[model samples]
Target: MDKKYSNKGLKIIAAEIQGSSKQAIGKIIEENNVGFTVTKGAQGPVSIAGIPHAVAFGADGKLIFKGHPASEEFKDVVREALRDVKVVKENLGGLVALGDVIEQRTWTNSEGVKMVAAVTKIDVDKVVFRLQKNGKIVPYPISKLSEEDQKLIKGMIEDE
Candidate 1:
């Protein structure tokens, strides 16, 4: 796949086709012909809601924006989503989500404090875990963990 599209870490999808707006969209389809899939059958939001509307989905397939695709607000939202994706990738060394149930694990920190926790979120410079003892979410610096723990956590600080 072209990095121009894949590197963005998200795909653009036009979910509904109906109304007089199809004329203009048809023209675009003919001009671009970039192999976007099409369905003769009707699908999606069911109601027109409106025409020429845009929607954006994030890497995790959640809607991030809804408006005219060309609108500045839509573009700004996409830009921000992309930036967030990049930041996440850098922090986790890959993509990850917020509430995934990271398997239960125990680790001892450099100060010899052994903590058992389930992973919550991986931040720019810390690993957030829900401490099993008190169910409190806390951020632990990767550096503070024991070498064995750090190695184990590093491999899993991202999406399952």
Candidate 2:
């Protein structure tokens, strides 16, 4: 679904409210080859009573549709919602969105420990990353990362 609608400016975020652990969610994502963001231990804006539920919002952030994503009705609503959607590359509050899909990469620390994540937001002295192993968002001091990682992040920001 992400590959199909990402070009249409549709951001799909699936939240797992079933009390799944990070490791469990990560395994499921890897096994299913999920391309979109899957957050664990999080709740959506509305109340949900079942699994495999979906809620879509328009470009204006209003509730557009709520149903199973595999349903034809949901697909129709998405298509209609996307018909007038315009992709915006503008900055989000102080956060920088690296295009439609944030590029994930392997980052290393000074101790040689490595983690795969994507840069979602950057601060003056810190960087926020969305972990690839699990959909956990974390903020770390820029100085704690490797020198090479620091350069890469700085270059990305400068390019923006």
Per-residue lDDT of 1-160 in model 2, one digit per residue for the tens?
6778675556778898888889999999999999999987665578775778888877677988887878998899888987865443343222223432235668999789999877778777888889878889999898999999888767756766
Instruction: Evaluate all candidate structures by whole-model CA lDDT and list the values in order.
Output: 0.62, 0.75
In terms of TM-score, how similar is model 2 to the real structure? 0.52
Runs with alpha carbons beyond 4 Å of true place in candidate 2? 86-160
RMSD of each: 9.2, 10.2
With a 3 Å backbone cut-off (N, CA, C), the pairs that clash in candidate 1 are none
Query: Against the true structure, whose lDDT is highest?
Result: 2
Model 1, residue 13: C-alpha shift (Å)? 1.3
Per-residue lDDT tens digits for candidate 1, residues 120-145, read 76654678788778989888888888
TM-score: model 1 vs. ground truth = 0.40
- TM-scores for candidates 1 onward, in order: 0.40, 0.52
Off by over 4 Å in 1: 1-5, 19-27, 32-42, 45-48, 87-160
TM-score: which candidate is best?
Answer: 2
lDDT of 2: 0.75
Quote the positional error of residue 110 for candidate 2 in Å. 41
